[model samples]
Target chain A: MSSTWLAEAFAVFGKDWRSEMRARHSVATLVLFALTTLIIASLALGPIGASPGERSEVVAALLWILLLFAAAAGLPRAFVHEEESRTAAALRLAARPSAVFAGKLLWVASLLAALEAIATPLAVALFDLEVASPLGLLAALAGGGLGLAAATTVLAAIVAQGRGATTLFAALAFPLLVPLAVLAVAATRSALLGGEAGPVLLQLLLYDGSIVVAGFLLFPVIWNP
Target chain B: MRATSLSFSGVSRRFGRVAVLRGAAGEVAAGGLLAVRGPNGSGKSTLLRCLAGLLAIERGEIRAREEGRELATADRRRRIGFLAPDLALYEELSVAENVELFARLRGVAPEPGLAIARRFALPAGRPWGALSSGMRQRLRWAWALLHAPRLLLLDEPFQNLDAEGEATARALLDEHLASGGLAVAASPVSLPLPRITGELDLAR
Candidate 1:
């Protein structure tokens, strides 16, 4: 009955949220992990009033690196929900792959958004960093999270098939993520150091937009295969 | 609509020149059970997979019903239910949960699924990995049946069935076939269908 892509995505996202509530695994673990990473980042970076670009670069790279791992951990758990249940076939039987991808993409996006929201404050607290413009940082996260979530979900699906897919996850991820990683680090630095955030963010937007489109187009192939 | 169908013209499949189904031509009747029997590597499973659209046929055309016409490879695939030995069920989930999850994927009605679960006596609390072979067989059977697929392409539906279990399984297949559903089963057992309408003997 859900005809539109957005509706189907909502349906898939709803399923994950409800399941997460029952399992109490995804949200809790992601938050804990993100906070712990923030602690390590603060200790490592120290109190440096470096250029805005430097701060943003470190933060963006570290954040996405963590998300890459988090997605690796979580996306498999998501698809395995269908596989171990022998429900992948069942799903193919009923719904189109576009719908499946929509649902899964939305679920990943929401989980990413929540983790970012939680990690932001924790990062600020642990690192003793000041956001030059709080609203800009939040906006950057909104776009970055959506793009990262979509790309990671698709990448994880292919990687999950490989043995000990955790290593495979990181191995396959770093290359595809280079553009976004650079843009994010740069954008964040600009935002934090009171410079023109525009050019850096435009690059980030391009990276994010391309990945989101790619994930959107190719997700169904993985869902059915 | 005469249901969805499949056809192969000189359809020969080879795995790196190891031919399994060599020009094996057979048409599975809609609303009927077709049993495929073969020795090890005799290609029974491969044949079933090919029909199910899992394994691609190497040198043949596969026609599936698309838009009420036999279009020789379209989306009639959705109408087929396939189960293989290596096919896995979720380890952490209980039987009822696993089945319910598949139902969610298939978008089948929940009540009838629960009814089937009840018939199999599948424990609501029993995880899939912990179940006995017979129990697992029953559970897979239920998974295949829940969607009411037009064709059930099974590898060995009777492998672990006890006499009673076999009878129950046969009865389920029988009832489904009786209601004009099709079942293409691959097994060594001589299933008592209506005089073996279509059979592929690969025990060569």
Candidate 2:
């Protein structure tokens, strides 16, 4: 039973990957938006020499803002594309609801990871951001990215059902993401200043866990409706 | 394979205050073809979706049983193949790739979509987006039949088909019925299949 679940989810994941590989539209849009935002914000900020602490806090906040908004823009593609293309019905009939949710969540998480790989380096290099604990910063980014994907993928499924889903996605995503963004930013700031980020990291992990559980439980209700 | 049966009783659905399907009911046993005919907004598609378990029925039970044993919801989904007018394949994928994906999702080895594609003269190497309306309709049939489901539910199954494509679809439906597979189809126009033994007209 578990094997079939895993196999079905993998099938969905592969299908999404192959389709995305052909189009690359969503990835291009996301990466471009993240790069453009980082460049514009860094240039606009000029050189902020106000102590390393203040600089770290501001830069960390800026990074989360960029990543969060980028996620809000792109993650909806996982479910929204299915809804728009009218393929969701075919999928619903073909795979289990939980399998579909798992597959979509995996796809969104992968996209988040890729976006971070590109955006993090650009943000660091362009902003001249200093991180005392690079490893801790990476951990925070991973946790934050997971949390962001978990929270938004379910919401994406919800909004995908409505007309004007794209616009509704933006309006619905921001409020739901506040808790994730706050913990992520705090952890990122702590990581940059070489402070103990373990507490915030733990909090982010818990948040990620809770949201993923919630998403799995709630997705069938949202999906089948 | 045991003879399959899809039975529904007093199935009703609503969108807000507007009831799309009220007290709609029917049954299609194996080797039987049931045509669901109605005008627009009569909930033909809604009935098909409810039977396929894609939509929740507000007040009804849709059961797919075999040899007197009821199939679970998940099992019923596996045994059923669904096609709708608006149902689409991956536009980025080739004809063969799209069919292969659906086959794999059904936990089956990819069969020859080539024969089906050739029957409709579908360009096997072309992306779905590049296919014409008739070709897309043909491919939808190919995808639907790849798994050889026990219960086939189709909505507006004859749309965008030329005479040849329509003939191909008819032949496919006939073959499914011959193999003791039950089929329920929704169409605005009459689909005169010799094998059709029952029908649910929503106009009432």
lDDT of 1 at B119: 80
Inter-residue clash pairs, candidate 2: none
After superposing candidate 1, which stretches have Cα over 4 Å from the reference? Answer: A1-33, A45-61, A72-94, A161-172, A221-225, B1-4, B14-18, B65-68, B71-74, B94-96, B125-130, B192-195
Q: iRMS of each prediction in angstroms? A: 4.7, 2.7
Question: Which digits, one per residue and each the tens of the lDDT, describe model 1 over residues B35-140?
Answer: 7787778788877777766566777765555234674222555556666665666556677776666566555665665676678777877977788988888777
Among all candidates shown, the one with the greatest DockQ: 2
Task: Give the CAPRI rating of model 1.
Answer: acceptable
- Model 2 local distance difference test score: 0.84
Q: Is the docking of candidate 2 incorrect, acceptable, medium or high quality?
A: medium
For residues B1-204, could you state the per-residue lDDT of candidate 2 as single tens digits? 245888888999999999999999888888998889999999999988888787788998788886567888767766677878788888999998887777777777666556777777888789999999888899988877877777898888878999989999989988888988889999888878758879889998
Task: Compute the lDDT of residue A176 as modeled in candidate 1.
Answer: 79
Query: When only chain A is evaluated, what TM-score does every model earn?
Result: 0.84, 0.93
TM-scores, each model vs. reference: 0.82, 0.93
With a 3 Å backbone cut-off (N, CA, C), the pairs that clash in candidate 1 are A9-A102, A52-A189, A56-A185, A56-A189, A57-A185, A84-B89, A84-B90, B63-B72
Q: Which stretches of candidate 2 lie over 4 Å from their true place?
A: A1-3, A163-175, B112-115
DockQ of 1: 0.25
Residue lDDT tens for model 2, A23-70: 995889988998888888777776644566776777799888988888
